[model samples]
Target: MAESRPNTEVDLNSWLPITASRKAKWWYSAFHCVTAMVGAGVLGLPLVLARLGWIPGIVAIAVAWLVTWYTVWLLIQLHESESGKRFDRFTELGQHAFGEYLGFWMVMPQQLIVQVGSDIVYMVTGGKSLQKSLALITPQADFRKTYYILMFAAIQLVLSQSPNFNSLKIVSLLAAVMSISYSFIATGASLWKGFGEHHVVHYGFRSTSTVKIVFDIFSSLGVLAFAFAGHSVALEIQATIPSSLGNPSKKPMAKGVTVAYLIVALCYFPVAISGFWAFGNLVEDDVLLSLEHPNWLISAANFMVFIHVIGSYQVFGMPIFDKIESTLVTKWHCTPGRPLRLVARSAYVVFTAFMAILLPFFGGLLGFFGGLAFASTSYIMPCAVWLKTQKPKPWSFHWILCWISMLIGITIMTLAPIGGAHEIIVSWKSYKLFQ
Candidate 1:
């Protein structure tokens, strides 16, 4: 007779342990995926739409959602194939697909870079919200940098000291609540004020050419693809749940991820569409800026933004620290005591602080991150791994579609220029002078 496989049952506790039921796992996966999608992506949509136009913007968002779903499917498939373990580390899947050495070198740095880039974006946005809030009390004070550092440090401390995954679940729940409340408040206020009536002027779409439309669609698609790229979190949760309760097959995890992404798209797309419709050409880089109106509404929005940012930092930071700890302790055989923990904490603080200082140079930062970092890791690398490792199933058409979407996403992101208003105005001036 074949030997029985070892049971992987874990004990549950309030302190640092990893026991979670199917219900807990579902909620955890849902919250993490939702939070990641909402962070910087929602805020950036209005500006993208204003430049690209309404039709292209809508198409981009829709296509991007499909791409995100497909990419996630590929990731989960890889996980299931290699380890036969649902919740293995992403790097392990890479290692199984590629060689161990190539996997370690490629996956580690890419994961770190993506996480760090995301944290920096959150820190900057959170700091901006705090600065705006403080300005209400001390109108002339400049606390942007100060608040950024403080928020970063606080997030680091919270993530580092958290006893277990349950705390993260609580944080995720709070984030969901804040996100729902903020979305409702912003939409309600916009409708009540007759937001469309105040639109000053409108600019016609710049390009009727097929090439221009394609380019616009591609650019917007990059943002949308990233908005739904956190399905790995769901995979992790699925791994922890009892296989007997649900199908041992990975279909539930994939289905859950699909539902979560659809929910996010529903919440985010309407807000994005409405913001662009109301503000037209005057839409700011951050849509939250466009939502600023009525003193009470502004305050409420600011507070919501602040909480959402904090929640984002906590969620992202925890996973990052967990990965770092695992690599150092298990892979490197380093003792993971107070000293190592402190070192990790200090590193996080310093990195976030530097990024906060560099936020004023947003164009350069976003360019480096979106073009080189995010595209390579989130879009290109995941697809490459899946294509190399997994056996094709009957429904493999979905996989082919995902790969194509990712290629389109990468091309679009690479071509989209970095600078915002200043760049646009300068380019227009140069063209006028030449004309």
Candidate 2:
């Protein structure tokens, strides 16, 4: 008998089939990846770069990029080995690669900590933007708490019922365009206004050394990593793409991941640099505030922030929802129907809303979440999985190097929040106003 050829058509109805074309896949993957990048870091980068200077900031970003790449590669390798698919839920990959028990525990903290934390950060940022925008119009109105509640409900409604992934592609594309457009506008406005003319000279590893600067830069590394923390989304994107691009190989998926990360870094770096250069020492928690432009630009950026939060909610919420549903159906024998999913998702929304209300100070929450929640998901868990699964294959020098870097990344993420913990506590006390 003649050898049979493999079927190239990716079944869209199947849960794990690669169904999108290469070009479409790349674009979609880039959208999610960049959205994750711009979520928290776009606002935080200016302060870090102002203190650390471009050199250290760039170095930290480079380290973050490396960590992101390795983490994605590990995920792809594990996914290929077990499910013959790309990673979607952390638990799915975990179960296949490790086993049920280990995967359950491994994914449990990630669902509670990283996923919920990301949602809280999104809601908090949205609340801050709402407050700022409202203050401009109805100066006397205290709408922060109301805005938070509304946003939480709105996001929950959208996420409770699953959305077409293609809609996400559109949202992601618009976000990327808005991010780039505002960045260019900000850069142009700063240049036209001569924002960098009165630049303050701050010494880093070169000039007069201060403990504060060193700590800030080190802490900023953690922040940067958190900013670049969604490489797994790239894997999901790849899984969504048609596997005919490399049906029997993982190279196409790897390429998609690499391209996605690079595009995100490109879009992010300019915004960070320009925002810092414009605001210098007086930079606010959100960099959009620093743009010296017409009211329209600021409004557009604010709206973009809202859209970005919606996208973030989807990316963060989906995996968490999937994990919760899986556990209920498989372990507890609860039916995973639409009603049950809604209930699970509603519970998450309520919980995240409570956190968002309790932690209204955007900057403090960003740092704390970056150090604790984002750190574990982006750095710690991936590293742990890589270490566990890639064993028996002798550890090469490169592997050792990656392990060392992972440790450093984890340490920075763990300890960086100490600098801001007191402020977060203080803000919690004052959060009642927002509540």
Best by TM-score: 2
Candidate 2 accuracy as TM-score? 0.80
What candidate 2 gets wrong by more than 4 Å, as runs, is: 1-24, 82-88, 95-99, 133-142, 145-149, 163-167, 192-219, 232-239, 242-249, 392-397, 429-431
The TM-scores, one per candidate, come to 0.79, 0.80
- Residues 1-435 of candidate 1 have per-residue lDDT tens digits of 222222222321111123233344555666766776675666667656766678877777776676666677667555565334553556666687788999877776766665676677677667666666556545677644555556655766656566334566777677766776676666565565444465564644434667655544444444554454464343444444445423553565566667667777766777677767666656665666666566567666766777786777666665566666555655675554556656875688567856565443332334344444555555666677776765456348756765686676567456643332233343345342211
Give me the displacement of residue 231 in model 2, in angstroms. Answer: 3.7
Q: How much is 357 displaced in model 2, in angstroms?
A: 1.4
The alpha-carbon RMSD values of the candidates against the true structure, listed in the order shown, are 7.1, 6.5
lDDT (Cα atoms) of all candidates against the true structure = 0.59, 0.61
lDDT of 2 by residue, 164-190 (tens): 344466666776665556556555655
